[model samples]
Target: MKNLFFLGEIMSDISVEELAVILEEDDKWLTENYNKLIQQYPGQMVAINDGKVVAVGREVRDYCAARQKAGLVGPLLINVPHPDDLEPFLI
Candidate 1:
């Protein structure tokens, strides 16, 4: 079974299992490259497609625009926090 999802102005059909796997892989990629991303794009939003950075911007809307312009379909978008903004977890 497949479900219809919106990717910008286009709608595509994807299976639930496929979407879950894609989300999992995207999350893993983010975790694996977190430090590098922080160093390169501190306090910015980054759009990741297939484990690569496709767009970056300071504002959410700007990043969305950039992502759309780059023709990225259902890419993972996440904000990289500045090191200073992270609170230390003291046990």
Candidate 2:
């Protein structure tokens, strides 16, 4: 029984497309680090943002969706200003 959690600042500036990208990337990263996360917590998927812990569940999809509803996307790099930053070097 895995539980998922997501945390972040919910503001009006967030975009759906940008959030989608973040979710996709996060999913990829999770898959890559699955072994480590599982070893530490066999049944928990916790999402953290700005040093705060949020939602917890067994399904990753559900966690991502909940975050989307809040308008925060991605486990993006701390320095990146927005999700589009992943597209090209912002001049």
Candidate 3:
């Protein structure tokens, strides 16, 4: 098995496909909870790991440091814009 670095985390003995699956799952989790999350963390950046909220703040840099300090690997980072600040978009 070889060591792989993903999102600043070293994943040992894991395949690329496995990593993809993990990321997909993360996306699904986020989508499912997006509405509730928007209300909870409006205008803030959120870090999620293992389907749970971990570190949160206004700056991505700060969240990165926080993730590193907490020894988190491949946590998903998302910025939740406040509803009032959202602009209409049409396609």
Tell me, by lDDT, which candidate is best.
3
Kindly indicate the candidate among 2 and 3 with the higher TM-score. Answer: 3
Q: How many backbone clashes does candidate 2 have?
A: 9
Against the hidden reference, what TM-scores do the models get?
0.76, 0.40, 0.77
Q: Is candidate 1 or candidate 2 better by lDDT?
A: 1
Give the clash count for each candidate: 0, 9, 0
lDDT of 1 at 5: 22
How far residue 29's Cα lies from its native spot in candidate 3, in Å, is: 0.6
Alpha-carbon lDDT of model 1: 0.71
Candidate 3 lDDT for residue 46: 85
Per-residue lDDT tens digits for candidate 3, residues 1-91, read 0111235455555678987787788778888998888899998888877888888888878788888899876577888878776556422
Lowest summed lDDT across 10 adjacent residues in model 2 is found at 77-86
Q: What would the TM-score be for candidate 2 when compared with the true structure? A: 0.40
Q: Model 1 off-target regions past 4 Å?
A: 1-12
User: Candidate 1: TM-score?
Assistant: 0.76
User: Global CA lDDT of candidate 3, please?
Assistant: 0.75
Q: Which model is ahead, 1 or 3, in terms of lDDT?
A: 3
Give the true-structure RMSD of model 1: 5.9
